[model samples]
Every structure is written in structure tokens, then in C-alpha cells.
Target: MAFALPVWLAVQEELLAYGGEVDPESPSCFDDFDDEALFQMFHLTRPCIAFITDSTRIRMKKVALKKPTLPVDAMVMVTLNYYAHGVSSAAIQQRLRLSQNDCLSIICTVSGVIAGMADQFISFPLTRAARTNVALKIEKLCGITDALGVLAAAHFKIRASPYEKDTFRSFVNTLGYTSVVSQFICDSDGNILSVEKCCVGSTFEQDLWESSFKGREMEDELHGQYWVIGGSSYNLSKHVLTPVSEPANEKENRFNQAHAKIHDVMRITLGSMKRRFRCLMQLGFAQEGSLDKKSNIIKACSVLHNISKKFSVPPPPVVGKIEPLHPGRQHSVPIQINPEALKARQELIDCNFSVASSRQDPPSETVTEEDL
Candidate 1:
């Protein structure tokens, strides 16, 4: 990830040339410059700085200043801009008055340096004590009651659909999460005395209730079948379950139900798919238009229109003209379609038609033939 040593050296030289000093109190400090100018200068020099800092001692030894290449200031400016905003080189070039090629070069070099240095910033897995501390923090923030030497089981809900509704169930006999839970218990100081290891078994209503109420007490013992945990402002109710047999058939059924729900949402809702397609199309058009400055807006619109037609969706409406509010000036407003209108149109399409096809002809029907 480290940039070439020469690139780093060049960046430092550029910074020095722009009345910038390593020390903050120096006569020629970066503070003397305006924000825009400082930003521009930083954008130009950052790549070289990253390169030099990230390079290993062995790599540094090989670097030489003989053949000077990309300016340090330009590389730094591009790199800083990229990190600040996830914009492409072409956009940076237009805004900064630099050539697209130069912008691209700096971005690539800085990216290489960042990639090399990524391991230094990435966090490692927490130890047992650290994990316990995290749990303690969560409990304190959430105001949930905790008991010492109690078994803690963590569960994850598989998303049935990306849009609308969250479905969660007790995870039983899952290898990975179960293993993690076991590790947490073993590592803790006398938290879990013993574990009842059971093979995947069928799920029963009683088992669900027990699982829900294991560590916590029930409020109403007779009719109160659920466990309530205290939240920051209120209590959250969790249904209790008894241990259930995990059968292959039951797992398959659950999986099918989840899968079917997702499929129905995606296929049946035209609004969902239409919105996704429109957003993607707009992004693609923007990228394409930015790359080729001479690209005609009309051509881009036509292409999008054709694409929409192919999908049987209506094209965005065109605004015929735009006039400037002030007279005798070149400044004029740009016309664009309203996103809300587009969404409404998509919703209408979704509600108007069913995705499933209807049967047209009957199985047993006699047709009258012409007299031959």
C-alpha cells in the first residue's frame, strides 16, 4: 500500500514550496493560507506523505530522488480530496482545475499507500475480559439486570427480507454462534458452571418458553408465560420457550418460509424493483456523463429512456425549457424531474397489475369448424 519513496519526497518538497513548515509555529506555516488554498495544497502533497510514512525501512533504502515524477502537492491534494469525499478522479480534476490523468495518478498512488497501511489501523479480536466489559457496558446503557455466574446466549436473526418486517427466532444447534457462546463461557471467570450439550432436536412450545426464561424470573408465575427485561426507559418482553427437537424437516420448513417471503416481496412489488433500477440508471448516467464532458445530455436521456422502455417502465418526464429569474445574464436554471413524482408513478405500476399470469383457455373446449 505504500507509495513509492520518490512520491513521498516530492510531496514534502511541494509543501515546503507552498510556504508550509513542519512545525506549527514556524514563520511559513499552513495557517497563513485560506481554507481553499490550504485544501488545494494538501490535496497535492498527501500522496507523498502517505508513501514516505508507510514505506518499510528496506523499501526506503531503495528509494532514490534521481528521476522526479508526479508532484508531491498534486498527489497530496488528490488523496486528501478522495478521502474527504468519495469522488472519482474526473470530478476532482474538474473542481481543482487539474488534468484528469494527474488526478487519477495521485489517487492511485495514495490508495496504494493506504492499502499497505490498512493493517495498522484495523482492530483485532477482543479478549475474554474485553468481551465481558462490552456486555457490561451494554447492560448499563440498556438498564438490564445482570447476575453473576449466569449463562449468556447470543442470538442472531436472519433477515427474512431487506424491506419491511424483522423476524427472529431462538438459534438452536447452530455450530458457529454456539461455538462462540461456549468459548465466551469457558473464558469467563466461573460464569458458566456447566453446559448441557444436546444434539439438534425438534422445537417444542415448552422448550421455547424455557429458553426465554432461563436466567430471568417470570413476573406472574401462573398466566405470565413471558420474561421481561428492563430497558433504558421501559421493559422489553421476550417470549419463553422450552428446548425443542431440531429436525431436518423443521429446519427445511423454516428456511422455505423465509425464502418465500423474500421472493414474494421482490417479485410482486414493482415499486421496489423500479426504484432500484431508476437509482442505478441515474448513477450510471451521471458517471458516464462525467467521464466524457462533451457527452450530450439529450443522448444520455435517450439511452435512459430506451432502457426504461425495455423494462416496460415509463421514462422520466422531460422539462421543455428553463429561464433565468434575472434578465441580461447567461445564468439559467436547469430542469430536472422530481424524484417524488417518479416514486408515485412506480407505486401506481405496482398496484395496478398482478405479476402472476391468468389462464386464458379451458382444458376441454370444442371449436366449431367451417363446412368443408
Candidate 2:
């Protein structure tokens, strides 16, 4: 006969011995004995954990030791909690009963593994068939036609270095914190198709895009028939659209009104993304060799966002506003012009007024809001 261990001690041992995958019904130290508690702990459901574990287990497996430092499930659990809460390594060690070094190592390793596997879930659909499906869904949601996707950028808060060159930001000086800005392009359903990461705090969405995958290429690829949209901060082009600056006339006013519909779409999606991964709320301080670790975490969050959306996991409430500030680029290079792109922009404007005059919602939701 033997006495049962204390509940807390037993749970600790169970977490330490955690192997294979979690059973959804089984108890977990990460949360109370409830579904909502589990969701709150990791921002992921049981199935979501299993889904990711299956893909990442190969890399996570440690063949060198008969008994690993931590079980694979425990490693993933600790990592998710670290990213989800943005806690210190010491706090994590205390919670999970690991050394400070082990806690730090596990975070970097597991975050890298998740980012490496991003391609499996996060993707940009290049085919007409795939794009068409996205366009249709967004149209129903936003009441705009021919929209490809929503483009938006939100700054993730990070602590600046003491020397501070890497994290310096003229824009957010008043806010008193630095950031590693990331830009995201997502389908109407808020699935990330592309990500631009590791940009410093001062970089605005416009400058960021010109240096990214969408800068000049979208015009050539979109031509006149398709379009993407963005906010007023973005300079409008043939393949892109923005709200009228002052609404010089009724036509422009109507265009601005139409732009609002797309704005709501982007707002909802970006809000959902930020809310789900609160770790991104303030990604802690930036220090030497810590940039890559944080960048990988951002990518992993995006991948997890896509997964949660796919499995019908409800997105958390959208919280916070986008900071408004664009000092503009310091020095400028002249942007080149293309005749076809000019024609396309004109056609888009005309199409906008036509819908406005008709007093009807467009058949498609091509009203996107992004530079790229």
C-alpha cells in the first residue's frame, strides 16, 4: 500500500514525465480542470496542440539521451506559455521546475521549430481558382468587389537595447518603447499569406512594402482586372487603391466610403491576430542575440493564427488601436511610372463611382487595404 502524492506534486511529476501527445480529457498543470482554462493557458485547444506536435515532433525528438532533459510535450507547453505570456526565464523555470538555461534554450529551440514548419500551414494562394475563392468570401463580408486581400501592419512592442541603434524609432518616441515591426497580408478570413518581419520600429508600412515581396511586383501581376487596397498612409497606384485625401468631389467621397468597408475587414482581422497571441502584446526587451528569438516567435504566432482560424477556434476580442505616425522616409528615390498601371487605377476609380451611382453593393469584395 502506498500514499498518494500531493495534488501539486503529482501534477509536477506528470508534467515532467509528459511524453507522446496530450489527451484532451487528461489533466494539465497549465490550467484548471476546464476547457476555458486550457484555452487561456496556451491560447490553443487540445486538437491544435496535437496538430502542431505531429509536425514538429521529428525535430523535437532527442536521440542522444536515454532520458531527455524534458519531454517533448512539456517542451512545447513551456514554449507556448513563454510566447503566450512574454514571461521571464526565471518565472518560467519556477513554474515548470527547469533551470534558467533550460527554459531559455527551450524557448529558442521550440520557436525555431514552429517557424521552420510555417510553410505547411501559412501560404499565399497563387492560382486563380484559389484566389477566386478568397475574393468571393471577402466580398460577402465587406460588400466590395474584385478584392484580393487585406494588407495591414501592427507593431509588436519590444524593449530597446541600451545602445539602442537597432530599436530606435522616431515615430514612437512619444510612446517611449521600441518595436520590431511586422507586416502581414491575409485573405479575408484572416489567414496570413505573406509576412515581412524584423523591420525596426521607425519603418512605416509604406517604406516596409517597397523593400518587400509586394512593392513593385503587384502592379505587373495585377494589371487592371484585379486590385489590392490599403489605407491613406499608402500612396495609391494603378494596382492599388486608397481613400480620397480630401474628397474633392462626390465621386471621391463615394470612393472613400467604399474604402471604409475594407477598413473594417482589416480592423477585424488584425485585431483578432493581436488578441489571440497576447505574447505579441509586448514581446519583452530586445538585447544582443535576442532579435532572432523574437522574430521566430512572431512567425510562429502567425502560423498558429492560421491554424486556429482553420480549425474554427474562436478568435479573441480585438483590442488596441494602430499607432498613427509616419514621419515618411528620410531621403527619397523617385518612383517610376507605368502606363498600364495608370489605366488600371483610372478604371478602378470609375468602377467605384459606378457602384456608388447605382446605389448598390458590389458583387465582389476586391476592396483590399494594403500597399503590396
Candidate 3:
């Protein structure tokens, strides 16, 4: 009787407190939405939601937690709300009825997981032939010779570090606040090929760029007739081609013209990314947390960006903060250019001229991407 009394009292309390039952004519959430509407809300197709939930479950299987805790679907829901809407944890808690800490944990965990799946989300072409394929696209779209991709740095505004004074001395002030910087390599199609984060805001872009994996990879992967484009920030190298400082001839002038076209494509790509995930666009991440949360947010966004492109996910409203055109000039950077690299660059310059100059087949020393 005592046990039954407790159950009866609980049921009475539930009914009395909530005004009959909690049921209603409609629920203001994904439950009532159609497939198209669901994607608009979640930024994920139904199949993608299932795949992510399945992946999260498989990853979390080793960790034993209380049974009454939120299921993997809810965890993913918590994470998706941030990517889709860039809402605060409190708002998510109110909307989804989960704790703020739960949302934080889920975001960090899911981001870290998705960040590691770069191979699946990013299209990093290997083998010379594969690279040539990418280069060909640049030629088709931007009319640049043997161009593989465009390189740029993206800055995310973070909360002013408690060590604001110390950071001032240590880093570039991102409009009077601490910020994080990541280097991006994107193909002609606006697909992000590589994203290297974890650098402090003050770090000089050229130095940060050189230390990146893509930097070293550029040295080895590109050879005779292959190169990537960068802004004036990067020093010219065997594999990297930057705009000419002073156009000595019509050929150099023409190269800059083609360069601007390709760089514009990169700008469009960065703009679309921030518009799709507004969190990176605004400034409200937890100030105390290490860049772990912000970095993961960005990492997850990158993956989702790829997923969006793949599935044709419509982007949110666009308000760009990442400038597509680059700053910093090359003359300011002192260069001890490698003799071989210098020679190679000249050959490339001459090669571009030949392509620009004539319709005849390019000499063996140069590669005309049109034939490829």
C-alpha cells in the first residue's frame, strides 16, 4: 500500500501540476516537420542524422553512463543546434530540455570526432594525376596555368582572454580582442581541402603557413608544372605562386589578372562557410574555455560544410566577416630564394607567357593545363 501510495501521489502531482496531460495539438519542433523542413532546421539530411547518431553510439559504447541520461540522438541534436543556428547553450537547454553542460560536452566530443574524419569530408588529391585533375579545374574556371588551389588565413574572434594585457603583447589584436587563426586550402570548386588551426592570432601568417602540413606537403607533392596560389603574405616558392610584386612585362601583368579571378573564388568559399555556420561569424563562445571548444566548433563546421556541399544543403543568410581578398605584400618579406626554385619559377613565368602568347603547343619545360 505504501509503494502504491507513492506511485499514486506522483501521478496526481504530474496531472495537477501540468493541467491534465502534457499532450497538445502540435509540437513546435522537428517532430512535426517534413523531410525538407527537417533539413532546414537541423542542417542535416535525415540519413545524415542517422549516420551521425550511429557513429556517436559506436564511439560512446565503451563509456558506461547512467541509463536515464539523454540518448545519442539527443546528444547529436544538441550539437546540431549550434552548427545550424549558433544558439547559446542556455537557449538550446530551453529548447531541447538538456543541461548546458551536456550541450558543451556533446559539442566538444562531436567536433573532435568529426574533425578527425578529414579524409572522409575533404578532397585531398594525391598522385600527380589527381593533382593535375584539380589543376585542370582551376584552369577551366579561372584560366590559371597549373594552379592547384588557393591559400588563405581565416580568423575567428574569441572572447578577450583574461590575460588580455599579456595577449596584447603576444598577439595581433583582433579588433581589440583575442582571436584564433587557421590556414585554409580550398580548391576551385569552393571545397575546403585543408584547414590547419591551433595557431595564436598574433602569429605572422607566413610563419604559421610554413609550419603547416600543407606547407611541407607543397614542397614534396608539386613538381614540374604544378603550383598553388597564395596572397602577398607567402614568400614565393617552387610550389607556391603569388602575384607579381611589379609587373615587368605583359605576361606578369596577365598572371596577376588570372590570380585575382582565382582568389575571388576563395573569398566566396570562406564567405559561404561563415554564413552556413553563424557561430564562427559571431562572438559568444565560452570565454574561459581553451580554444578546444571554438576549434572544434570550426572543425565540425568544416566537415559539415563539406557535407553541405555534397548533399546540396542550402546555406543560411550570408553576412561575411572573412574577407576574400588578401592583405600584406611580398616585397616586405625578405627572401633567400633557392636557386633551383627561382629557376623553376622563371620557367613557370615563361610558360604562362607562352600559353598567354601563343596557341602553339607549350615547350616540354612547361605544362599547358588545357591539354591535360
Top model number, TM-score: 3
lDDT of 2: 0.62
Q: Residue-wise lDDT of candidate 2 within 86-179, one digit each (tens)?
A: 6644555676788767877887777888887566567766678877776776656544567677666666777775566643443242245566
| Candidate 2 vs 3: which has more TM-score | 3
lDDT (10s digit) by residue, model 3, range 1-372: 012234334544544453433232323244555787766667667645554554444435433334426655667777777777777446558767767676767677767766665655666666678688888888765556777788887776655546666654443433444567778888877778888865556666778677888787777764445677888777778778878788888777666767776776667776777776767765453333366667667777887776666555556555534454435323454777677766776676677654564432222332221211
Off by over 4 Å in 1: 1-68, 71-73, 88-98, 143-372
Q: Which candidate, 1 or 3, has the higher TM-score?
A: 3
lDDT of 1 by residue, 167-247 (tens): 112222233211011101111111111222111111222233244433233333332322222111111123211111232
Measured against the true structure, the TM-scores of the candidates, in listed sequence, are 0.26, 0.75, 0.76
Residue 171 CA error for candidate 1 (Å)? 31
lDDT of 1 at 180: 10
What ranking of all candidate models by TM-score puts the best one first? Answer: 3, 2, 1
Report backbone clashes per prediction. Answer: 33, 14, 1
lDDT value, residue 31 of candidate 3 = 56
Q: What is the C-alpha RMSD of each candidate to the true structure, in Å?
A: 26.4, 8.9, 12.4
By lDDT: ranked, best first: 3, 2, 1
